[model samples]
Target: MKQVLVFLTDGFADWEASYVCAELNKPNSGYQVKTIAVDLEPKTSMGGLRVLPDYDMSTDLALLDIPMLIVPGGTGWSDPINVQAKELIQHCFEREAGVAAICDATTFLGRHGFLEQHNHTSNSLPDLKLGAPNYSGDEHYVEAQAVVDRQLITANGSAAVEFTKLILEKLNVYQGEVLEQWYGIFKNGIISA
Candidate 1:
């Protein structure tokens, strides 16, 4: 199975990527999920949940043939430690691979000029500009729950379901009516036949 690399760091929001990871594991979803960190040690989430990563950033990700990268938001994202995460996301983008981020993690992209040319959004435009003062994509920002520009996907913290739906759609894990039905069941509690 192809791997989707999810970057983890201290104070990471546990809710952002959970649905996407779970949905990607369904039969024929065409992907498996792996967590990566700066090191091999365990990291704690904002809610105090601990998770051990499957690999570290130094693990030669290119050789692993990773095609997708997911980054969840956290307070730690504003730290200098996020440089590693930025590098990884940049590498994925240069390779034309899929990149997804939510909440504050969007600032990582904004700070580095990644979103300067891509239509995107974050927890808020002001917050994103606060993190990356040089960000020039202000006019491209949308007020929607989630936004996708080519291989890059972004969302706010409260838009996890919509975020996951966009990722799944980008990955072709679900599409058209099937995707809508899935969203209905999960987002609205209405099961479809």
Candidate 2:
């Protein structure tokens, strides 16, 4: 079973994070989903919803050896806890783990020097400089969705529901009827069996 790790923090975007997990957890999807947080207790979402984390950051993610990591955006970017979160992200990058960050969290990738010369985007471009081939769009999410350059895969924001769908596609879950079903859901906002 392939595993996906969601890096959760206080004020994380609930819709983007939870929706991705829920979609990937579909029956026969072959993905094992887990949420990791800086703390062990439940964390509050930007919408004030509480989300229970499956593990703490201190826990060795090596056991699961996740193939992907999803980072959802929120005010947590400015919090001090982001320091450690950034380190973990760097570690994942070093290990060749596929990473996706939505909204402001995308800035974290820029800050860590991980996106140099790679096309990328964030909710708001920060002053922190990077040399990546970045682009920003007006849409809530970049329609092109996940841009895979080498080992890096990035999505602009939540506007592109296809972001997670691309991950599933890469994992070999979004094929044939599954791909069609995902497209229908994106176009009509409904999922059919």
Candidate 3:
């Protein structure tokens, strides 16, 4: 199965990547979710959840060539840290793989100039501008639940549901009517009516 990597770090918003990982874990989802951190150790999330990374940044990350990369927002991403994670994201982009980021995680792409010509949305544009030097795509910013520009997907923290929907759609896990129904049921509890 193709793998989807979720970046793990201290202070991560546990809820942001939960839905994506859950859906990807389905038998026929065609992908599996793995977590990566600077080291193969446990990290505590903002919601007090502990997660152990499946891959170590220093050793296994450069060798990982996956299609989808999911990055959840947290305090950690507010700074220009995690060079290894950033490099891995760049590599994934060069491979034309899908990169999804939510909330503060968008700053990672911003800092790396990935959002330069792509439409994106973050928790706060002003915050992102203050956090990243290469954030020069303000005019392309959209005020939506989620935005998908080619292989790059970005959303604000409040748009986790929409973000999950887009990621699933991009991965071809859900499509057309199936995707709409899934969104309606998950977003509005309108499974039937």
- Model 3 clash count equals 0
Query: Which 10-residue span in candidate 2 carries the lowest summed lDDT?
Result: 131-140
- Cα lDDT tens digits for candidate 2, 63-181: 77878888887778768776678767877777888787776677766665665656655543433233123533223223354566555566666545756666666667777787878
TM-score for each predicted model, relative to the true structure: 0.95, 0.80, 0.93
The residue-by-residue lDDT of candidate 3 on 24-122, one tens digit each, is 999999999988887777988999999988887675555766889999988777544565688778878888999999988888788878898788988
Q: Given candidate 2, what's the lDDT at residue 6?
A: 87
Residue pairs clashing, model 3: none
Question: Which stretches of candidate 3 lie above 4 Å from their native place?
Answer: 60-65, 79-81
Pairwise TM-score winner, candidates 2 and 3 = 3
Q: At residue 178, what lDDT does model 3 achieve?
A: 91
Full-model lDDT for every candidate: 0.89, 0.70, 0.86
lDDT of 1 at 177: 96
Ranking according to TM-score, highest score first: 1, 3, 2
